[model samples]
Target: MNIELWWPKLTPSTRVGLLENNGDAVPPQVVAEVTRAGGSAAIDSDSEESDYYLSDEDVEWIETVTNEEEPTEGLILSKVRRT
Candidate 1:
């Protein structure tokens, strides 16, 4: 999924909710939206040692969007399967 395109489409409230609650508290409607946007939820089995490493582009995008040099944990943006 191209998160750059999907991120801008989210409602401001939803975006704030996501940032505040992180992935765990994301509503089903938002999860559906993410799925429809070609994003998948992160599996519990996944680990730092897994193959699903975020690219430099993903990291840069996250930093830019969150405006944090180090983004908080559990962001759905971090879960996006960039293709």
Candidate 2:
């Protein structure tokens, strides 16, 4: 499953965790769930073969789901420039 496909199924807390941790520090259960959903590669930042950078739509969805106004200065998403 693509991140876009599995993302909406994630619990709010799980989504917030991903946003807060910048794709790092994912809980093992969440990882397992993502793997089951075929999105394991999407969270593996260390995998050279992984092309899992967040898209603009992903960022928008995160903000909307989390009710965040915008990426703050210290948020990792703030540094991501989706082209």
Candidate 3:
């Protein structure tokens, strides 16, 4: 997907991490996904503040290499016990 078409779909609330001085540019699909999830995204130097951060190369991987069908299927989940 072209970044120009999907870039506007990103909401201000979506947080995206971007590395400075990296040659790669963020794909619009990533931004669209973040916004669709109702989260905030931005390219910033500080990773501590952002909910999710990724390097320029990482971003490219996410957009091109990452599996879109099962985005988070590999994660291990645990049930929380109530006090």
Clashes of 1: 0
Please provide, for model 3 over 1-83, each residue's C-alpha lDDT reduced to its tens digit, 9 standing for 90 to 100: 43323334544332233222123434566545845644334666554543333344335434532223322333222211222
Ten-residue region with minimum lDDT total, candidate 3:
74-83
TM-score of every model? Answer: 0.45, 0.45, 0.24
The lDDT leader among the candidates is: 2
The candidates, ranked best first by lDDT, are 2, 1, 3
Q: Candidate 1: where are CA atoms >4 Å away?
A: 23-25, 46-64, 68-83
Taking all chains together, the TM-score of candidate 1 against the true structure is 0.45
What is the lDDT, from 0 to 100, of the residue 29 in candidate 3? 64
Candidate 1 global Cα RMSD = 9.8
Better of 2 and 3 by lDDT: 2
True-vs-predicted CA distance for residue 52, candidate 2, Å: 13
Cα deviation of 5, candidate 2, in Å: 0.7
Lowest lDDT sum, 10 consecutive residues, model 2, at 74-83
List the candidates ranked by TM-score, beginning with the highest. 1, 2, 3
Q: What is the C-alpha lDDT of each candidate?
A: 0.50, 0.53, 0.38
Clashes of each: 0, 0, 10
Clashing pairs in 1: none
